[model samples]
Every structure is written in C-alpha cells, then in structure tokens.
Target: MVFTREKTLDRAELEAYWKEAPATLEGHPIKVLSGYGPHEVWEGESTEGVVIAEFPSMEAARAWYHSPAYQKAREHRVKGAVYRGILVEGTTPQD
Candidate 1:
C-alpha cells in the first residue's frame, strides 16, 4: 500500500483504524513484510508512507480486503489518509 498525505489526518479516525484493522487479520495468513520504517524512494513518485504485505495468493488478498470486517475498518482508514493499494503475484524461480 502506498499512502499519500492529501489533507490533515483525522486523529480520531486514524486511532479507530489502528484499533480495528488488526482485528480483521484473524484467521488470515497475511504477513506484514515492511511498514512505517526508514526507506528512500529510488524512483517514481515519492509517497508519504509505504507498506508491503504478503498474502497467500491474489484471491486470498482479495478475500481479506473485501471481507466485511476489513471493509468496516477501511472506512476509518480512508477517512484518515489517502492510500493506493494493489495486489501482485510474486515471481517464483523454476529449478
């Protein structure tokens, strides 16, 4: 997820998001690879923040994203900050 700060963040909404979003992870095999860490953008447009997560598959990622619990949590996220989220398959080398 790539986030850009578009406007003043609503702290209440963000607090709610942080409180609720993690609960939606229950039973899902989502792995947070990187987030809110020091990093430099080597290319492309600079963003305010970036998060990298790994899901079992595209379908799994979609399932989690579209889940009712997550959708509800996402409401607060959208209100708090602007984000660009995408799912892409990772490359696996063949022997």
Candidate 2:
C-alpha cells in the first residue's frame, strides 16, 4: 500500500495508528521492503512516506487490511492525515 499525506492534521493520532497497526498482523507473514524514511522522487510526485509490504498472497493482504483491528486503527489515520493508498498485485518473472 502507498500513501501520500497532503496534510498532517494530528500527529498524535497518526502515532496511535502506527502503534496499533502491528498487532493486527500478528499471524500474517509480512515483509517490509521499504518505508519510513526520506526518499527522492525520480519521476512523479510522492508522499512524505512510502511503504511496500509483501504478503504471502493478495488474499492475505486484503484480509489484513479489512480485519476489525485494522479497521479501528484506520480511523485514526483518517483523522490524522490526508492520504491516498492502494494495493497492487505483484508479478513473478518466469524463465
């Protein structure tokens, strides 16, 4: 998921969201490829933070996002920052 925050209305709320997010993925396999740092936009515009998480499958990713715990945590994000997010299926290269 990629998020672009146009404005941060509440830092405390955003922090709370992050604090609660990890518990939601307790049993799910997740890999963080990149995020939570400064980045240079080589092409189009970008947000303050960019996160890429690799899950076992698309379904798992979807479940995690839709789970009740996450749903609650998401409320904080909604109130914290102006953002845009998306989920894209990845492709595996074949020989």
Maximum-TM-score candidate: 2
Residue pairs whose backbone atoms clash in candidate 1: none
Candidate 2 C-alpha lDDT tens digits along 1-95: 55566578899999998899888878877787776667777886666777778887889888888889889999999998887777878877899
RMSD of each: 2.7, 2.2
RMSD of 1: 2.7
TM-score, candidate 2, is 0.84
On residues 1-95, what C-alpha lDDT tens digit does candidate 1 reach at each position? 33334343787997898899899999888998887677787887666766788887888888889999999999998998777787788888899
Tell me the whole-model lDDT of each prediction, alpha carbons only: 0.79, 0.81
Against the hidden reference, what TM-scores do the models get? 0.83, 0.84
User: Model 2 scores what on Cα lDDT?
Assistant: 0.81
